[model samples]
Target chain A: MSTRLLRLLAPALLGTLMVTAWYGVHLWLDTEMRFLLPTPVQILGAFRDNGESLGRAALNTAEGALLGFGGAALVGFLFAVVLSLSSLVRASLYPYLMILQMTPIIIIAPILVLWVGAGLKSVAIITFLICFFPLVVNTTQGLISTDRNLVELFAMWRTGRWQQLVHLRIPSALPYFFTGLRIAATLAPIGALVGDYTAGNSDGNGGGLGFQAIIYSSQAKYPALFATAAVTCALGFIFTGAVVALSWLALHRWHDSYERADR
Target chain B: MAVPPIVELREVTKRFGDGPLVLDRLSLAAQPGEFISLIGPSGCGKSTLLRLIAGLSPVTAGTLRVDGVTPDAAAAELAFVFQEPTLLPWLTVGRNIELAPRLRGISAMDRAATRQRVLDLVRLGNRADAYPRQLSGGQKMRVSLARALALEPKILLLDEPFGALDEMTREHLNEELLAIHAEAKWTGFFVTHSVAEAVFLSTRIVVMAANPGRIHSVIAVDLPRERTNATRASRAYLDLVADVSQLLRSVESTAA
Candidate 1:
């Protein structure tokens, strides 16, 4: 087969095999135990019945994820800039930042709920905390690891610290920044869902997929639970896909990773 | 009365944080429009000398002056090119060329004009919109050269700028560089390993010795000022290259 055909066919083939295995397990299970594993058909039926609510939940989670991701990107970039300014500053503060990253979000979620009260605010903060570390780490590494010769070239012109950061360091750091963004992209939705699960409002109108998961699992709606999971997975893919598109838009013309082999 | 040297070094010494000396009491001077090549074995501090003159690093001791001022103070009058092209990959050829002027807060119109002039000087006028990655190795180096020239510097310090290029491209760039130098008349301090390159480009070659690097000899080239491909094959140029190579070999052996 042609490469393009193989590329498309390979994934479809794997998916067909996976669905067949899943259906076989579903059929082999005792009817009393079937609730533990909804067949693909049952999950599809759940999607048809709860499509509108699932869509709303997906949107709510997306809003929270995007807001948190934006806040993390802005604050993380500024923090990295500050850290990149001086070795003394970086040495003193980097450990504290590491400590923040090391402290699990589960341990901090309740404190966030108490401080912010359970709602979108807590959800956003939780998401921010989850996505912030990689952005700061990657951007700082990029900022510091600027090409030595380029730095000297800038220094030769008596380039001020600010100009050097803006012109040389930041541009050079972009590929790295995108790498972090992609990582954060994969995590953002998960963060939002976790936040919503722990601290979100229980209203039917605004409850995210995480809240929906709670409702479906409590009611023992196995098929609906499976559908919620598929939706969450799709949301994660959407976030990553957006980031990949943005990266291509920013870098495809110049970056080596994005350059076409044929070209 | 004599014209003052544009760059003067007196008993200059440098070392890195108690490390062994990289350049020891090294002193040299360049008249207003001299092209000086520094050639020596690896680790002889040819590059370090260029960095000191460019104000990228401070001298550990002694005095070095450019245009009657410290290198730091004279930074606006200087530019440097590295062995690698060092062109910002994110920027187009034109934007890379305009980088210094833009940072210096030159108005947009002037930046555009200066970019055009330098791009044309490097014979990359049509490639202004191309990114550094889109260009060949030689083209990237040309952009780097253009970027340095955009500064309109009075002193250009290049540390083995063409060392990574193939011989054919290296020779091509060397000819283009001399052409630009002839017109711009900047005081050039070039560090290189190629004897023929040194002879072809420099009015004076400073051969250095390693192990506490110091200038071992300075040879003046009596070839015509305006050089071309023919000059590379000329009897005088060939003889100078041979003589400099022999001097360099002797320096390396003794230093070893």
Candidate 2:
């Protein structure tokens, strides 16, 4: 088979096998408590029935994720640039940044709710916090890891620091920056969902997949909960896919240079 | 009467950190339109000396000048080509050539002409839109040469620019380089390990030795001015190549 056909066949076969197994398990255990773990078909039914409500929640969650991701990209890239300027700055600031990364976002979201008050604002902050670190670390590595000969070429051109940053450092950092962005894209949604769960309303009042999932769990609506969870995963997949596409478009030519260097 | 040297080096020295000197008390002068090559064995600071002239590295001692000015000032008049073609992969052939002027903040209106001019000079005029990866090894090196020439620099400093290319490509580029230099009239400073290459390209070859690398000898190339593939087969070319080879063999023995 051709690569393109194998690519489609492998994933389709896997998904089919997984869903069949799930349905078979649901069929074998036919108890009144079977409603607790909804099967694939019931989840799909629940989504069809509550499509409007779920779509709203998913949209809200997506908005918060996108906002937080954009903020992280800008702030993280600037932070990496500033951090890379000197070893002294990196030494002084890096440990504290790493400490923040060590702290879990779920734990921090409640504190953020107290400070920023629970809403999309706090959710975005939580998402930004979770997503920022990878961008910082990866982008800094990329900026500093430019080719030595290219750096010397810049010197020969008598280029100013700003020019060096624009032409050399920025382009060199692009593939790594995109790598960081890809990480942040998937994590942003998770952060937003966790933020919604920790700080959102107890009822299905707040606008997010996490809030809806929390409400479904509380009310014993297993099908809606499973459906929302599946949709959230899909959202994450879509966000990551978009980022991957962006990276390909931007760096396909020169990005291969980094790969070649690695080999 | 002596035409003033475009580049003058006197007692120049370089050492990394507190370690022993890599280059010691080197003195040389490059007159206008001179294609001077620094030839030596591996690890003789040949590239380092090239960098010092390019002002990418500071000299440890003594004076180095381009047109009676500092290295930093000298840089404005020179373009450097590395052993690896070093074309920015992100850029097309045209954009790579345009980079020097772009870095210097030349306007697009002014640079369009110069960028086109150099691309044509290197015979990459048609390949301007092609990315670095889209080209062959020779084509990429041609782009590199075009990039340097695009700046319209007074001197072109080459650090074994064809060191990575195949022998045929190397010879082809050497011929192209001579043709371009003949028309452009810029001084050239090339560093290489091959004696044949040195003789083929240089107006004068400054043979070097390792262990605090310093100039061992300088041989003036007396081949005919207008050279072609036929020139490479001539008796004078072969004899000159032999003379440089003998000098390098002596340096290698001493280094060993």
Candidate 3:
């Protein structure tokens, strides 16, 4: 591997090594009394045995995350447009958005589950609630931050509000909206996982990864639980990385932040 | 031959929010095809006076007219250039120039023709696709000038358009400005601080004093119609610059 690639991989490799060392201690502890932590080798074996089932569960979780994220993006963008266009709407609705943003996702997840019932709807609602705020806030700020002089220039020419919004405000808001989307994407997987835990079992029998975590903890299946967790963390990383790549591609044409910094 | 003044300001006074008055009872008029420059210190409200004429800001008290009508009524006949390059950073240079006529309900084909003509006039014909970021400061200012000219207004109000440029660039643009005015014959009221710049480009220079901006004197430049680099070295041009410099010095001393 190139030195640069190695440099990027070093931290992850070190973290894996430390985790393995910790797992060894857990195995030693399990031999004595507690079965809390599991050996890395045993966990990997459990992962291999359960790979097919876990992969299916991962797909289910990914579907919920994708649906929720896409839906929230559309809604948040519309809200941002409304916020920029109508000061009265912003004045009336901004505080409510702030409330939605600050409310704990863990607390909201159970309530969403109760209202929407089990399965995809509940999970999607939870993910959307978690992901919507940043998109709205960033997009609103971007739209509002247009150059006053340029705005006046358009006004002098008698450009209508709708035309200005279409040609100016929205294009200006793209980089900011994508920034929000990238952040939301990272949080999306966690939102779906939490929703699954709160909303109870899928098909009234199969515990998704999150409920499997709860069940494994109850049953003292430490290796299986640890394996499930490793997969969940991997899922989160994959989602977040995809968002970063997407954001980089989207804004690389205009914004400097996406450009790779020279030494 | 007997056309009236294109724009007239009758007893125009302007004050900011709860602040002191900026322009006090300023009365000025621009004859059709006349080029006038308003020169003063930084806080002399020359820009405010320009904005008054452009109808960007309402006069606090007294009549502000353009093309013998109120600015609101004469909207089609007035164009303004701000001190800064106010080109839309997001739009291409050609689109920025096309904005005014497009907003005025002109057809796209006509707007495109006008845009091309104005860009050619400003000598920015090749930079139509470039964004504002890709432009040099001088080029950006040129784009802004093109945008104003694209409106093809009878009266142009410029608020120190080349104030931000270096001395060489400023001098160069001053020559280009004179050439444009000569060809188009639009009535112009340009605001600036440089004495030589005002004398070189203007038919008449209106010198103002600070702290309640009012005209101190109006010096009519008697230089020849053809102002080349050689004109800057002419005795007549230098004498006019000296006279305006003396007026500015007197204003500064009186204020001090």
Query: lDDT tens digits, residues B147-250, model 1?
Result: 88888999999999998999999999999999999999999999999999999999999999999999999999999898989998799988888899899999
Residue B206, candidate 2: how far off, in angstroms?
A: 1.0
lDDT of 3 by residue, A1-263 (tens): 69999998999999999988886677678466645665677788888977776777777777778888988899999989999977888999999999988998778777776787778788888889888998899899989988787777666665678888987788778888988888888888888788777774664346467666667678777788878778778888988798778777766644546445651
TM-score of every candidate: 0.96, 0.95, 0.89
Give lDDT tens digits, candidate 3, residues B47-128: 8888777777789998876877888778777788888898766568988888777767889999888888888887888888
Better structure of 1 and 2 per TM-score: 1
How accurate locally is residue A86 in candidate 1, as Cα lDDT from 0 to 100?
A: 89
> Could you arrange the candidates by TM-score from highest to lowest?
1, 2, 3
Candidate 2 has an lDDT of 0.87
Deviating ranges (above 4 Å) for candidate 3: A1-44, A85-88, A203-208, A215-224, A245-250, A256-263
- Candidate 2 lDDT, A1-263, residue by residue in tens: 69999999999999999989887777777688688668877888999988988998988888888889999999999999998888899999999998999998778877888897887888788888889999999999999998987887787787789888999999988989998999999898998888777775533345788888877788888899889888889889999999988898898765564346543
Error of 2 at A96 (Å): 0.9
Candidate 1 residue-wise lDDT at A89: 94
Top candidate when judged by DockQ against the true structure: 1
Residue-level lDDT for A218 in candidate 1: 87
DockQ of each: 0.84, 0.67, 0.39
Give fnat for candidates 1, 2 and onward, in order.
0.89, 0.63, 0.29
Candidate lDDT values, in order: 0.91, 0.87, 0.82
